[model samples]
Target: MIYFDKVSKVYPPSMVALQDISFTVEPKEFVSLIGQSGGGKTTLLKLLLAEEKPTEGTIFFESVNVNDFPRSKLPELRRRIGVVFQEFRLLSNKTTFENVAFAMEASGRTPEEINRDVPHVLELVDLVEKANHFPHELSGGERQRVAIARAIINQPDVILADEPTGNLDPLNTWEIIRILKKINELGTTIILATHNKSIIDSLGRRVITLEKGKIVRDDKEGRYVL
Candidate 1:
């Protein structure tokens, strides 16, 4: 449902975040992006989300050119995609349930819809019992689960997860991965950008490796070979 065609992003001066990168992610597919620090994985995700424009080439979400979207249309584009970050970007004052509900609220969802969907998404992430807890009250894994719950609450078509397990222990990491896999199984396209070899290796999914801003490998059932 996403396509990148010869896309490149360059910051001021000589900084190149991505160089001539191209790939396609089909609906309901689970894809892994693996690369070292500053290797352009995050830049690729940003371009897809239209947080940054490509310096060259184009990015397409379904058939619409993401970079061509006007400012007013950004919310509409973003609503089709969910994002999970390494740091649990939850509001400190908001409870877990409220954090998940906030996305819907921002999108102008009705109170009735928020009430109905928040609980269901929390259950999907196995955080139903902790819904009333704040981010600090939960463990690292629980916090990340809350983040995931929030991301999926709106049922976005694609979930772009950037190092969602980076801060967790092995057990917690696995737990997060399991939740992501479950979401993928339930028909959400997942684009996971991570540096964890063990997670990538174990996933055995489509692996796209970048080296110095270029795609070096694109393999189906690929292992983490950096």
Candidate 2:
């Protein structure tokens, strides 16, 4: 389980990005983090990634405190979690297959593992035909699928999607959502941070709503009321 205990982040000059936030995410759970922009949605995700330090409180991944990890060990922590972002952050020079392969390579996977897993995941994302296409050669939805493919190539314990469908049309948005749901159903945990009401309402999963850096609502089988 992942636990955020009384976590808070305050920037310089009295800006509070998060305030006394607390929550727990069980294994294989699909949770949505929803709120308006500047409501600490991004900040909270960053803290989980150890990209920023919390001003107070603790974040626990299983038993260890994420904040206590040394810089060298941070990579180990991050390797267990996958992150997908609004902008499909792919290498402009690499093809779809190479883009996903690069992630496994960075983690020191062997040639055999890379050769075996890359095609399998590409097929999972229905990108086998576009495996040789570069980012510039693909559509926005295809690029995002490549991003998602890269994120899941390592089979991380959880996937954190930050406004992943923000740039796609409704058709593509649902496509991405379906892919995420498939991943979750396959036993990977998913923490989706999005503001699309239709997506949230359609999900009917756990919703944790934040407003001005405070959690205003949390419900199972939730809809996007805010």
Candidate 3:
């Protein structure tokens, strides 16, 4: 569903974030990107998300050349992708339910659809009971689950979670991983980027290791070996 072909991303000041990285993620696959800091994993994601352009080569979402996508269609493309960050980017003033609802409203979804889908997604993340709570009123784990709920509310085809468990304790980390596993089981392609060795090792899935803007290894049922 996603392909990066000889893609290189360079920032100003001659900084190369990714160097000719190439990979293909089949539909419904759960892939882990394990790498040290500044290793181009996030850079590759930015390129795929259309937040940044590749300096060389190309990126494709399905059969469409994402690098060449028309500017006007970016919102449509983003609607197909769900992103979760280490820091849950919830609105401070909005309740958990509203936070997820706002995402759908931004995409011009109808009120009927938003009302129907938001509750279902919150339930999926086990946050239905906390829907009325504000960000500060919830625990860190609950907040992250709200973020995940918001990401999946639109039923996006791919979920990009970068360091999702970075801020949680071991127990909460496991909770988040389980939630992600559930989402993957529902057939959403999942791409997880992290430096956490233990979490990656416990997953025992396809692991890709990156170093200094290049991928060094790609394996199935892999362990995190930095």
Candidate 4:
């Protein structure tokens, strides 16, 4: 459902984030991106999300070139993809339910839809009991679960998770991984960019490794060999 064809990104002066990278992620597949910091994993994801324009080649979402999307239509493009970040960017003032409901509201969903979907997604992430609690009241794992709940509440076709477990302990990290696998099993395509070797090794999924802005390896049932 997603393809990057000979894509490259270069910043001002001389910073090359990606160089002639090409790959395709099929529908409902779980793909893991592994590399050291500044290895271009995040840059590749930013290009896919249309957060930054590519300096060369093209990125395609299904059959449409993502860079060809007009500014006014970017929101529509973004709605098809969900994102979970390491920081767990929740609203400090909103309760767990409100946080998830806000995503639906932003998409112009009806109140009835928000009410129905929010609870279901929270349950999927195993956060139903904490729905009324604020972010401060939850543990690190619970807070990340809330973030995941919010990301998937829209039932997005693809989820881009960047270091979603970076802030958690090993136990919490595994918890988040399990939830991500569950989401993928339910038919949502997941592209996970992480540095956790154990998580990637245990997953035994498709792995893409980058080195200095280029793909070094693309393996099915790969390990975290760097």
Model 4 Cα lDDT, one tens digit per residue, 57-107: 999999999999999999888888988888999998999999999888889
For model 3 the local lDDT of residue 96 reads 97
Candidate 2 lDDT, 26-132, residue by residue in tens: 99999999999999999999999999999999999888899999999998888889999999999999999999999899898999999999999999989999999
User: Can you list the residue pairs that collide in candidate 2?
Assistant: none
| lDDT by residue for model 1 (110-223), tens | 999998999998888898999899999999999999999988988899999999999999999999999999999999999999989999888989999999999999999999
Candidate with more favorable, higher lDDT: 1 or 3: 1
Shift in Å, residue 168, candidate 3: 0.8
| Least well predicted 10-residue stretch by lDDT in candidate 3 | 36-45
List candidate 4 stretches off by more than 4 Å.
Answer: none
The alpha-carbon lDDT assigned to residue 213 of candidate 2 equals 94
Q: How many residue pairs clash in each candidate?
A: 0, 0, 0, 0
RMSD per candidate (Å) reads 0.9, 0.7, 1.0, 1.0
Q: How many clashes would you count in candidate 1? A: 0
Q: Which 10 successive residues of model 2 have the least lDDT summed?
A: 73-82
Model 2: residues >4 Å from true position, as ranges? none
Candidate 3 structure, TM-score to reference? 0.97
Steric clash count of candidate 4: 0
In the predicted model 1, the residue pairs found to clash are: none
> TM-scores of all models?
0.98, 0.98, 0.97, 0.97
